[model samples]
Target chain A: MHPINRRDFLKVASFGGLVFASGLSGCASRAAKSEADEFYFVQLSDTHWGFQGAPNPDAKVTLPKAVAAVNALDPQPDFIVFTGDLTHTTDDPAERRRRLAEFKKIISELKVKDVRLMPGEHDASLDRGEAYKEFFGETHYSFDHKGVHFIALDNVSDPAARIGEEQLAWLKADLAKQAADARIVVLTHRPLFPLFPQWDWATKDGEQAIELLMPHRNVTVFYGHIHQEHHFKTAHIEHHSAKSLIFPLPAPGSQPKRAPIAWDPAQPYRGLGFREVEAEHDEYKLTEYPVVKA
Target chain B: MKRRTLLLGALAAAMGSARAEPEVIRIVARKFVFEPAEITLRVGVPVILELTAPEVAMGFDAPGLKLNTEIPPGKPVRLAFTPDRPGEFEFVCDVFCGSGHEDMGGVVKVLP
Candidate 1:
């Protein structure tokens, strides 16, 4: 783990980036020893591989371009996680499976060995995630990396956009084993809070899940579903939504409907991007990168 | 003035009678489509949508109409509302049923 030197810190700070670092501990001020524990993971979401529409004409190459971009990282991310929506929704079961398979094959090219995946409603809700599970293993699971406990919750599987009672129980049991101030990161496909319920931008029982995590002091949630980068907070827990790889959607309730913003001919892939989340203990620094360089 | 008051009372009574019973429409929700996908209704007329999911749990959400409900398997879920405006509104099976769930939506055309 290379310590971020003053030059590297200056370079990131010059870009007026790391907006998430606000109100949290300063990354530059931390001791080099503590920086040794700092590790970042790449988050790419809503690839919607099989999608073909006006929103993104280059859908076929977007995922591959993103994979190439991630592979170009100086020291590759500790791991890579696709928040959800691995494939476009399809009515045919065989086609759905094929899309998932194709999506998996594309991501396999990532240089990162430890790649984690979850499902968005598009990839799951149809068969209650039966096909998604066949490809991605489990819709929701947890793991530990460098003292940070990461929990991936599946809010898309139930179709009603719920984390469900069973998963809530699992979350409760999982949190019970952790300290109140334990560094925890939650990954989900839908916003756990009611960002825009009318547009289905909410998880039906997400409030219940939030209640379960409220007791913990150091909990941050990263999700992807709205297909654009958004930030919110439910008390102390900070929720950040990632941009989709395929296209972008209007801001929460900004429009009467939640349709994909039309692709721009001059500025292709304008609102599509991925993120790198650097975790130094409980504090995080998020840096966004466009799908393609400007 | 007395005649006008009598006429107003009769109009109120007629409106009351209209509200006494609402038109019921039954909609069946399957894997990826809603039966009777396009429905037409009159503005100011009260309607009760009897929604059912024959195979699995589903949802009826028409945000424009402010009607949303869960249609549990083997049970019918009824939602009642009066179309206040005249326009084409959309109601979708918000619950994930299968692969085509995203396209499982119907339009409710409320005639003025």
Candidate 2:
């Protein structure tokens, strides 16, 4: 804010993001929606709602800014999905509830008709989404959206942070039940394959997840724990890390302390924000936009 | 009544002959770092660090102070230490914070 007022910059920045969203209009608009091209969901990850720290003066502003960015997209998503870390620390149950309530308030401001949610380690750090599920829905479940089979896995539980034996089994059976031609999309808080175990990432049992999804022809894994955006391919499956609405984290093993990537005072909210995932015709397009410049 | 009062006064005087107990030092926390990072206290004084945070998890970490405790956000946690030697001790926030996190450091000063 020293160089420019935050709110003023936010207005200009948000307009810029909207402009960017509109500018990307070309590559995406050609993707045309169809009964076969039917699956589309927004990825909103790492919204550490209750984070209070010096990394950013307005921890409060970052989340709302991301939501505004998401809402500004021209083609409204079929539904929006929050990847996880609904709150920070995850110590107090009341604090968790309070933060989730605030999350709802912020999301309520959005015009998107449908929204789905999942938990990351921060939100479920202590209680493992016991409170999150109470407010949202089942942590790991699956549904179908326009000829595509969608599965949301719970991978932020306990130290191992696996999809759990039960959820993995459910995923295998769910995939087995789907038609061979159906597009498969898996959602979880952590990346399925090891992105950076040194950073306490990579699910211990993610290999099982990878094996299960490998059989599918076209499968895209959606995850949100890393905060910084990244994409990797393991065994024919597409894995992606979503940006957090909270503070950005350093790359895995980037620092010796093993702490999260901190905020950059000069480039605050740089790679931290939201993305629009549109599956249409023959391809899936993920267009990312920063919240601050939104 | 005079005899009873005299007996009570004598008992109180006898109890006062014991050595003095140690004093405690308190430190409060919120958001990122602890308050009064450089705590000054007697070598034998019991330094009781009362760390409080709203929703950001933080810890009271100090090696010279020989103290470390992870205080999950929203709850107040207390860390107690008694530095045997008098010198400079360092404290840091173990929780990963953005940007100014490395700066979320503190110091403890022990007196002879």
Best-fitting candidate, measured by TM-score? 1
Question: Which 10-residue span in candidate 2 chain A carries the lowest summed lDDT?
Answer: A18-27
TM-score for each of the candidates: 0.81, 0.64
- Model 1 clash pairs are A85-A120, A90-B99, A126-B98, A159-B96
Candidate 1 shows a clash count of: 4
Structure candidate 2, residue pairs in collision: A13-A293, A14-A294, A85-A120, A249-A261, A250-A261, A262-B98, A263-B98, A263-B99, B38-B107
Q: Residue A30 deviation, candidate 2, in Å?
A: 16
Give the per-residue lDDT of model 1 (tens digit) for A103-203: 98988899998998999999888788899988879988999987789999999988788888899999999999988767789999999988876667789
Q: Which stretches of candidate 1 lie over 4 Å from their true place?
A: A1-19, A22-33, B1-20, B25-47, B53-57, B62-66, B72-75, B80-91, B98-100, B103-112
lDDT of 2 by residue, A142-252 (tens): 887775678888887542365778888888888888754457778888877767544446676889988877766677788888777666667456677787787777776
**Candidate 1: C-alpha lDDT:** 0.84
Q: Quick one: best lDDT, which candidate?
A: 1
Best candidate (score: DockQ) = 1
